[model samples]
Structure formats: structure tokens, C-alpha cells
Target: MSISRFAALALLALPLAACQPNVPQESMTDPQDATEADIARWYIGTIPDDPFDIPQVDTNLLPEEMVRQTVKYNGSEQAGTIVVDIDSRHLYLVQNNGTAVRYGIGVGKQGFSWKGAARVGRKGVWPNWSPTSTMVRIKPDLPRHVKGGLDNPLGARALYLYNGNVDTLFRIHGTNEPWSIGQAVSSGCIRMLNQDVLDLYQRVEVGAPVIVKRTGKRVVANAE
Candidate 1:
């Protein structure tokens, strides 16, 4: 080929190369060697201003998909609605901008799972816990009243769900067991990471609608 022809081909290839996606650089540093400060850099960092000291989460324990992030939402639900997909183990807080803040969640196991709509009747910070009569019957040793703290089953925040004027006796709350964030092990309540629950608690308001669906459609992650 002539030199002029070769130059034209090279220019064509340059545009194609520029259009290629830029891949993120992989870290060579070992996660096991990560320091406390390094771990604190996680999106879900320790919350210092909280009434009780919230510790930084060790992200290694959580699956990458379980990490909180904003994702594309295709549902018709209005902004401020909470949609929990029990099958996908995901909770989406709908936004007005065609996106939703997604969080990993733990749902009830087996016979404990239920599906329906409810409203956030109340919000609590470091709330006290009282086992239901049914809960007491199942676990007779369970304390009727437990003061709220780090040791409490409801970690840092709780959003009490209500059906009309009646309390559903179920909740979406932070869990003392962070590792259970993506599992199906809770008795009936939806469990979230303490940091995530704190974030959710702030964005949501009393009387916000919540839909819990067993086989709901999963939200697709935004490619951009």
C-alpha cells in the first residue's frame, strides 16, 4: 500500500481506540493487609456522630453486589417509595430521577416470609425491642424488653411498618449481625447494615409507602 493509504488507515484505527472503554485499575495491595483506616474508606464508613459509636464495616465480609449503590429503576413507583424484593434480597428507595438507591438486605427464612404493602408508621433511633408473644412462644427465654444499644438485635435504627392504622409487628431495621445482610435468616423483619439503615432512615419519612414483593422484578444496574 502507498504511504498515504497507510496513514488514512491508521487515523481510522485511532478513533476506534479512543472509543474503547477505560478499564479500572486493579489494586495490587492485599485485602488481608488492609489497615483500619483503609477499611474505613469503604462507602459504608463508621458513623461517629451517632448516639452510639458505630464501627466501620469490614467490606470483605460482604459480596460486592450487596454493597449500597445507586442503580437504574424501571418501576412506576413514585419517589420516596421503598420496594423490597424478597426473592432478590434487595431493597430499593425510589428516586425522582429514574434511579434508586439500592441496598442489600436479609429477609425472613422459609415460613416466616410475607409479601404486601405498608407504610412507615414510626422511626426510632437506638430503639428498645420487645419480642412478640408469638416470638416468646417460639423462644421462651427471650426477654420481653431489651434496651436499645449496640448489643440490641435492632442495631442503630428501625422503621416500623404499619398496615393502615394497625401495626404489622414487622420492621426494616439495622441488624447487630452485619454478616447476615445478604442472607435469609431473619425471623420476619428485614435486616440491613447499620450504616445503610442510618442512610435509609434519614432519606425516608413517616407514612412513606413500602412494598414487599416475593417475586418482584429486579432493577437493572446502570451501565453509565
Candidate 2:
């Protein structure tokens, strides 16, 4: 069936499930005809040769648009570039074709949001996390260090952003809180689901250009 037709069907069925427990009422909006098979394939619980295991995400609780999928890319960025739209809470990895693999992201909350162009200076697997001094000041009880693991806030992987040799102290990393995807609830970093981050970690390399913008404007990355 056509995408439009499938979306229409999904809309028609939404009211019947609206009152169900743990179902988001607004999920039918921008439906992409995602099936159980798609969810299963995209969010598998195990990884080959990996010591850590991830729990399957309950996609039903998330807005349909937040689920990872290939979408038409209107941006002019070259393939392998990463574009983050803070306003939309979405991140797009540009593909060779006129398309991008979009992932739902949790952006910074209120005063914490930032916009800029940077490079992925480093990459880490199950990266250890240390809350910045500012983060510590904001939350005095927050832990200073968290070991790399399933419980770590920077879940399965991280792509550290930098400007030249200077660390921006910002990252695009996995989140332990899967339900926070597509929400503005972070401390100025881009948060992705663990499974999503694992997929991205394998595709992106260190030094990949990253553009982060808000209000529909593009920020061009500086030459390295």
C-alpha cells in the first residue's frame, strides 16, 4: 500500500487505541507505516561480539516520527555529514542519494540549547561520562563519574564534538532514557536511543562534519 494510504489507516485506528495504557495519543501524526517487523529489525536486543546487551524499546510509547527511518533530504550537505535540527529534535545522517537516515533525538532543555558547526573529533564505545562543572553546579548531587555500561547516561556509544583541536564539551551519544527521545530534556547534548547510537557509531567516523541549527537555518562547518 502507498504511504499515504497506510498513514490514513493508522489515523483511523488511533482513536480505538488512544485510551490504552502507555499509548501516546499523538502517535498517529506523521505515521510512516512502521510495522512490528521494522521495529524488531531496527531495535534488536543483541549485538554480535558485543559484551553489553540492550533492552528492546517499546516504540508504542514514542511518537511515530521519533522512530528511526529513511526520509527525503532537502539539505545540501554531502553524504556522511550529520545535521542536527534542535527545534525539530531530529538528527539526519546524509546518504549518498537524496535521502538521509533520520533519528529522533532529545535536545537540550531551555537555556541549555546550543547551535553551531563542529567535527566529530573522537568516538567512544560505551563511553564513560563525567558531568561538566556546570552540570555539577546545577545538580550538586550528580555523580562526577559514571563507568561505561548499560546504566551509564551516555549509553552505547558517543561521538564527541570539537572545533579544531578544542573540545566543545558536547556530544551526540546514546541515552539510558529511551522515552526521552524527541523531547527537549538534555544538558545541551544530543541524545539518541542506545540501539540507534550503536547503528550510528558503526556508520560515522571520527572527524565527520556536524552541523547543528535551530529556526530552520543551516550552520556550515569550518574547514578542518
Candidate 3:
């Protein structure tokens, strides 16, 4: 149906699945609706970055045809099993059943795609950026650290990926450059729209299971 109807249905469905095993949902209190600032701060402890400071756009921006379409969430869409389908360039937050809140995503370049399971170990809003040594070496003009704002590549939200207790340094975050949604430009992180990432950041919380697959992940229907 409509986005609101879909959201309401998903909200109704959540409580009924309480007995199932997966990530536990955090009790929401601060404004039920996920806000861009809430998500941004949740990740980096601040509001979003300014736009004028962004670096030159990457030349590897994605062409629509390159974005695949078959990425699907195959498990409990409950707070667990956040799947990013690289081949399809879509990120799915599976709650349950045959439904998932799917959003288009941007992924890594040729040798940059990574596959593994992780958790949203941490979060941020309007996050700051620091060029990895690799990015600095590759783009001599890149800054060592950037102040958060519109131009900041970190965008609206940041879901820090982790596995067990270790940080993977990869994040499913927002991009101010919305056109990059279906492209491959970053080192190995997944990117989403500022709105989409804000929406996702509100839906997800710490201790959630995140699966990133370059090809795809198999889903077990009704796993919740």
C-alpha cells in the first residue's frame, strides 16, 4: 500500500513477534519518528555537516544500469538480519515475512566489496570524516579529518558495523551526494540517501545483526 500504511502494519506486526529469538528492540522514547539529526548524533555525537566542505565528487559515480535489482531480505525482518544486497545495490531491513523496508544503496568499488556479518556497534548523525591512510595516499588533496556538515560525505546517519565485540570500521551511512545511491565509490562502506539513512537509523539500534554480501544473502522465510 502506501508508505505510512506499510509503516503502521510493520509497527503492528513487531509486538506480536516478541517471543521469537533475534535482536531485541530498544524501547523508543525520544520522538518516535526517526529524525535526521537523531540518527546523525547517535553515530558521531553531533548534528550533520556543512555542504561547502565536501571534496570533489568521485569520478566512479554509479550509472543506474549498474545497480542490480534482486537483493532481498531472506530472514526475520525483526531488529536482526539487516542485509545489504551489493549485487542489487539495495539495503533491506527485514522485519518479518515477505516484507522488508528496502532502500537503494551505494557500495564499494571493484576490489572494495566486503562480505560478512556485523552489528550496528555504534551510530552517529552528521558524522565527521577522516581519510584513511589509503584514501589520503590515493587522493593527495583529501583532508585528514573533516568537520561534519552538508558537504561531509558521512551524510545524515551512520550505522557502525561490528562483529562480535570487534569494530569492522565499515558503516551503512548517509551521503549528501544523493546521486551516488547506486554507485561504487567509497573504500568498502555502504551508502544510502540522507532520508533513507535517517529512516534506517531510527529503525535500527545497537546490537542488531548486519549482513553485508557482495553477491547476496540467503533468507529463511519466517525465521523470526
Supply the global lDDT for candidate 3.
0.60
Candidate 2 vs. true structure, TM-score: 0.76
Q: For residues 180-211, could you state the per-residue lDDT of candidate 3 as single tens digits?
A: 56657667899876656776888887888888
Listed in order, each prediction's TM-score against the native is 0.76, 0.76, 0.63
lDDT of each: 0.74, 0.74, 0.60
- Mind giving the per-residue lDDT tens digits that candidate 2 earns over 1-224? 33234323333433343333554433222224455232232232344425666544556667788888888888889999999988888899999988899988988888888889999999998789999999999889887787887667787889999999999999999875565688777899999987788889899999899999886332322211
Pitting candidate 2 against candidate 3, the one with the higher lDDT is 2
- In candidate 1, which residue pairs clash? none
Displacement of residue 47 (Cα, Å) in model 3 is 13
Single out the weakest 10-residue window by summed lDDT for candidate 1. 2-11
- Model 1 reaches what TM-score against the true structure? 0.76
Model 1 agreement with the true structure over 149-206: per-residue lDDT tens digits: 7667787899999999899999999875555677788888999988889999999999
> What's the distance in Å from true for residue 6, model 1?
70
By summed lDDT, the worst window of 10 consecutive residues in model 3 runs over: 37-46
